[model samples]
Target: MRYEEELIDEVREKNDIVDVISSYVSLKKRGSNYVGLCPFHNEKTPSFSVSRDKQMYYCFGCGQGGNVYTFLMEYNRLSFVEALQELAKRAGVELPEREQTAEEKQQADARLTLRDMNKEAAVYFHYLLKSKRGTQALVYLKDRGLSDEMINQFGLGYADIYRDDLYQYLKAKGFSDYQMKESSLVNIDTVKGNYDKFFNRVIFPIMDINQRVIGFGGRVMGEGEPKYLNSRETILFDKGRNLYGLNYAKRSRSKSLILCEGYMDVISLHQAGFTNAVAPLGTAFTPNQAMLLKRYTNEVILSFDSDGAGVKAALRALPILRENGLRGRVLSMKPYKDPDELIKAEGQEGYQKRIEEAESGRMFELLVLYGQYNQQDPESRTEFIHEIAKKLAQIEEPLERQTYLASAANRFMIRKNDLENLVNRYGLGYQYEKVNEQYKTPPETEERRQEKKKSNKNQPQRLLLTWLVEHPEMYQYIRAYIGADDFIEPLYHSVAIMLFEQLDNEEKINPAAILSRFTDAEEQKEIAAIFNTHLKYGLSSEDEDKALSDVVRKVKLASIEDEMVHTSDIVRWQELLSLKNKMQKFSISRS
Candidate 1:
């Protein structure tokens, strides 16, 4: 649910972004905006820029950018509503209660129905675990070192061997087969008739961060092909988007999350008092999962299995973690397959010791890559070094890159300068092409090239919108020829609609308030980048005029070409061609 735009804007107006951000981050004014080391990622230099003029913040290093609500959501792991409530309270403003729209209300009702069904199903499963029919299943859990209290805490249960047991129970409780199927608790087949989804398996209820049961996972008590079966995607569940024990892990005071490989591993860790442990839903770690982790903590330690598959999974997860602005570490559970095995061999203290000595995300990747090649052989070692250089090049911040590069050089007995050169060579080749395309002049210095790497038809639109944001006075002349429809780029087009509306009404253009209109983080980030786009300045007025003209012409040409592609009518094509040629001669008016 979203608050009304007027109410959101009022709250935002009271809580200045710079003032609010200053309480959390030590920001010092540099030029027109505030500059500080980005709190989202580790950096020696201050790459995070906060603009009071626009009321937005962006990490030039990590690409995390947004308005005030976004800042709270990312920095403190609060949801949009949560952030809104906090800001409203802090500013001593009252948020007005509002009713949901017809569509929103209907959607809400459906979600509520699903939640109620999942909750009822969870209760039934938990009750069965303590019943006479669940004796063998209970015995299996007990043998696996699960106490009655732990079982109760996790809402663990068992499905009887009878296929129709749960189906009948749910049906008697007034939940239709359609609802049951939607909840993924029961399946109705024409040939096999209706039956339970899980039979003769230990059930683990997968709850959301609110501790509401959204889905379930069942591990087979005896021999089975899958061995572990998780609830399929339903209205209430998306395995890729949700983690198994986040409800508990989010509350852990620890600053890091311990990511395990499976349900048993997560439960075992929780039982052993590592309350911050979580796991993916029976799949490889995903970018979404890492971003989810980013909300709770900046660090996530990978506690995957130590076998070949586990090593591969860890390697796969590390880059995703780094990309999502997390400081990922990898722990070794050697001589033991998993955390559960390790807890049995050595106690909680030993596990803590292993965690303390976990390898840094970079070191782990480097060491794994190093192990893959014969270090003593020159050709293999050179290949290994190049791989190392490529990985180093991916780190956008030079200081951080140099720090890791020097460490890699020292570890491998290579010269720091040589490794640094290899990294820069790889980094610059790609950066030059991308940055060169965005700007007319070749990036003469590192700072110029590091502004941004965007290249596409959208770049001009992004550039023009950014220009309007920084210099809205130009809209008096710019609007005569260009309009929202001319943006062509979908996101830019949407922003331009609002921007042009505000400009037309002669309202003060507040980029921050405009940013608050977007709800999704990715949308807000792109919107922020639009407001904060780095427009390279030319040396003279003539140069600046020429650059602006080029951007306007590019934007107009792209829109014309786009219209011609969709229109089959010869008249429309001819009109588009005439406009394209006219736009080529379009000049800025001073009036």
Candidate 2:
């Protein structure tokens, strides 16, 4: 009925499901269908299957299944309309008359205008740096030993001294104060109204993993009170989660990720030919940031500043990395306090050598300082060992802890047996696998329940729902065989009912079709994830006789279970047999 829906229908009619899917996946023929490794999630074996007759695909491994349109949405992270438009272009289909709500139209227009503003601003600043006005900033960057390639790679720019310059430019280009604020390109002062936050500074754009300019970071041209300035928090910018230069780093390298303290360190490392590098925004290292790094490289080399504060920060971050299943190590830089200075002192090759020599340290080693091991009094030493042994027991690795014990024993001139006895006294066992399991869970407590509740808030349901919408042919089969009523979990049940009802009557199932029915965006997401998990199996051509018979038997059993306590339990059974005999004689006449 809608223009977008009509467009999607046309695209689906024009493009064969197999043709579109084959573009991204390596499909191998097996009997009547094709099989491949699931591209959505990391897995070694093939669970992804495509059926030409059904015009759908499924993954048994990840449970992601769908038609060509759904494949594009998940693989490329495109919206429904975007995916439709792309398929239409490939299929050569003309779109129908378009209509969008006034609010939707305005938001789309605002994003376009903001993008233009950002592009123009980035180019303008780059031009300013080449001009006489940008000489001071250019010299300052060079003084920091940044190469021209490095500067250009980061899209380094300069803002004029006047704060109103960017503000006026953006306003003239038809961006509202709110739009500029959303883009994180402008800041508002109570007295000054709107102004450029990066005025009179050299700018480095902070990009997402996809390399889009989500926000900016600026450093003063010369010595200023606040030496470095960065974009304020906005809708498009989240400093705690984003890393600089990861977009390029992920594409260029596959080995390891270099985690540095500052944005400049990340930029400088990329410039030095160590392409696999990333750095967090102003916030301290987070569990989320650690998990993100794990996607690209399980191994992480941290290059914190060589100061006391930096050492303490690294120590604090080690536990977070270990908890997230990343193999983390520390890069101790010599002859310089920071990564930027170290890279500048030694050429790129010198920095590479240090990264190679990086050493892995247990969290306890960093937390306890060497002085605790060498206390003058034996009692203090014993107490120190007990305190640290408890912490080491928290570590999930068996051999790693034993290795630490052996090393600690050698350093403290204590017998290995004594160290092992002390560790056992604290109930820190030597079994890495079993010990890791003990550390996995805290006792059932109110605080732990609250933490779980907080985490459940961020679960991705829309992704699951979208997957379901993509695979419509499986609707009847899933309902008949799997039974929507079997889903007892609240979140899964809500999605199952919605999906079952959506496909019950429709000739074709489009996930976007049901988006209008649910006002809650999170519900839409949950529906998507549900489909994603189910689509992995797709629809089977296998006979449903057994499944259907089982359902009937269950229904019969439920009736017996419900009537077990009748008013006249024995007489009720005789009455039921007489009623069945009478009903059978009437059925025989109809036959």
| Candidate 1 total steric clashes | 0
Residue-level lDDT tens digits of model 1 in 216-248: 899898899689899998756877768999999
lDDT at position 455, candidate 2: 34
RMSD (Cα, Å) of candidate 2?
A: 11.2
Tens digit of per-residue lDDT, candidate 2, span 1-591? 345544555677677777777666656787777876566655434567876755667775545666666767666555556677788889888776677666557756765665576777787788888789899988888887788888888888888888888888878877778777777778766776878877898888777786677677788766785777777765456665577778887886558888888877887777778888888877777665665676677788888888777787888677667655677888877669988778778878778888888877574353445455557788887777776666656554678878877876777666888767777666535455443642354367887688458435322233223434654553444344344454434555565576667667675654433332343435444443444442233324343333333333343333333344443668887765654444233210101
RMSD of each: 8.4, 11.2
Error of 1 at 388 (Å): 4.1
Clashes of each: 0, 19
* Top lDDT prediction, candidate number: 1
